[model samples]
Structure formats: structure tokens, C-alpha cells
Target: MLDQQAVDAEEERLRELATALPDLQRQQYFQQLKRELRDPDTYAALNWCFLAGLHHFYLGQWQRGLFNLLVFMAGLALLFSPWPWWGLLFIVLISVAELWALFRSQIIIQHWNNQIMRRLLQEYSSAE
Candidate 1:
């Protein structure tokens, strides 16, 4: 249940720590832990093998999860639509899009985590 506020607060705290800390050893350890906390491989597996949006939810991306869920539900509805041919086409398109997402899941999540880290570092530097 990581709400936006909590995530923001934690980022702020990490920024503060980054500013106050001068020990490279400690900073490296923190970075390692952060990477472990958001392992891209694990998230990719979750996204592809289980729920399509589970990785997004795990990363505190509720909106992304919601969007994926809605799209998936719409695809499911199309499965029972009156126009079976059109519905099948729609489902196929959605499934293709999903496959694209699955292939890019690791890169996407890694990029997101990197952005967060970079932003925190920038904030820390500015605070100092």
C-alpha cells in the first residue's frame, strides 16, 4: 500500500541522507540495496508470467496498473461481444500490445528506477 505521499516522503529522506553522507562505502551500499529492492528481472517475470500489471503495482505505480487492468478487462469483454470477428481482432491487437510490453518490461522498470535515483541525487546536490 505505497501511496504517492509515502513514496515522495521516502525519496525526500533519501535525498537528505545523500546530502549528509560523505562516505562512499555507505552510499554504494545504499545504491545496491535500492537496486535489489527494485530488481528488474523479478518485475519482468511478474509482469509476463502472472498479472500483466502486477509489476507496476509492485513498483508503486497504481495508475499504470489500473490502466492495464482496464484494457485487459475491455479485451475480455470483447471476447463475448456480438461481433465475434471484430472482437477477435481487437483481442489479437491487445495481445500483441501485451507481448510488446512483456518484452520491454525489464528495460522500462529499470529506466524508471534509474530516473528516481537520478532525481534523488539531483535533489541532494541542490540541497547542499
Candidate 2:
């Protein structure tokens, strides 16, 4: 439900916090941030292409990705087995969730990036 405006506001707030750091630390901080930041376009692509929750893995949500992968594999197995109905149900459920992620990929990615920034800043502060 987040618009680009909200993402921009959060980024601006993070930038303000960065002002407290020394120039050298700020440079290093931004370098690290750039390395760790996630991309919305990539997330959306993964969601659309795989639909097996690989997008979650891309964002470091390994547990959810594994769950989705397992569910997808199980669904495939069931789809060919005698009880295809169960497989169909599982596939439908997972697909619905993945579709939701695809639609909200921008918001999800921006929020994740913001969280990453906050953590990096906290870690940097504690080190000082």
C-alpha cells in the first residue's frame, strides 16, 4: 500500500540520519548500502518468472522461499498423482500469494531497503 512518496520520505529520513556520521564513515556507509540494497525490478521479475517464491529468496527470506519451493514441488507431485485436486488447491494458494507479492513488489522492496539502511546505520553507530 505504499506509494513512491512514502519511499522517498523514508530515504530522505535515512539520509538525514547519515549526516551525523563523519564524512569518511558516511562514504563507507553509502558504499555498503549500495552493495546491500535490493531491487524492485528484479524482485518483480522473479515473482513473475518463478512464482515459486524465488523472489523471497532474492530478498534473503530463505525460509519463506524454501516453503514456497516445497509447496510448489509438492503441488507438482500431487498434480500428477491420483489426487490432483489437492495439488491444484496447493498450487492455487501459492499462486495467489505470489501474485500478491508481484503486485506489491515495489512496496515490499522499498520497505526492505529501508530496513537494511536502518540496520546498517545502527551497526555503524554501535561500532563507534
Candidate 3:
């Protein structure tokens, strides 16, 4: 639910500002960013394959991941009951809801990385 152009422009602006830093400072920025950056492909794969919000965990979104997992487990519990359709429907609904992330994973992870970069930059600047 983000504007692609705006997010991309912000990332570009951040990159430019980073490049203007002295060599050592810029190196530190990149090193930290590299360690923090999450891979879109991996997130996408987890979302697509699991459809259970494991992808959120990969990006350090623990609450969302746990919520999804709990719901999925509840659905599974319902699945074993006499009314099997309820569980099936619950699972399908959650899967459908989460499916959007599969398509927009690249942008999602890019935004997350940008946030990390922005925070690191702010920390470096404020430390001075």
C-alpha cells in the first residue's frame, strides 16, 4: 500500500546522500545496511510457499508473523474437527489476504531496507 515512485525516489535520495559521505563513513553505512538488508526473493518465496506470514518474520516483523501463525494454527485445529469446511475456509481466507505480499515483495523489502538505511544515517549524523 505504498507509492512505488515515492519510495524509489526516497531510496535514490538516500543513496545520493550516502555517497557524499567520506569513504570511511560511507563504508560503514554500506556495511551495516548489507547486514540488515532483507532479500525480496526470499520473502516472496516464504509468502508464496507458506501463505502463513513467515515472510513477515524474515523482515523482523514478529507480531504480524505470530498473529498469522496463530491464526493458521487455529485453522488447523478447526480442520481436524467434524466441521472441516470451517477450517478450510479460514485457511483460504488468510492465504488470500496474505497473497498480496507475494506480488509486492520486492517493493516491500526495499522499503524495509530503506528504513534501516535511513535510521543508520540518522544515527551516524546524530552521533557527530
RMSD of candidate 3 to true structure, Å:
1.0
lDDT of 2 by residue, 1-128 (tens): 67788887997898799889888888889999999999999999999999888998998899999999999989989999999999999999999978988988888898889999999999887877
Task: List the candidate 2 regions with Cα displacement exceeding 4 Å.
Answer: 1-7
RMSD of each: 8.7, 1.7, 1.0
Candidates' C-alpha lDDT: 0.64, 0.91, 0.88
lDDT of 3 by residue, 31-115 (tens): 9888988999999999988888899889888999999988888789899999888989889889988988898888888899899
C-alpha TM-scores of all predictions: 0.60, 0.90, 0.95
Superposed Cα deviation of residue 113, candidate 2 (Å): 0.4
Which residue pairs show collisions in model 3?
none
For model 1, the local distance difference test gives 0.64
Q: Ten consecutive residues with minimal summed lDDT in candidate 3?
A: 119-128
Error of 3 at 22 (Å): 2.0
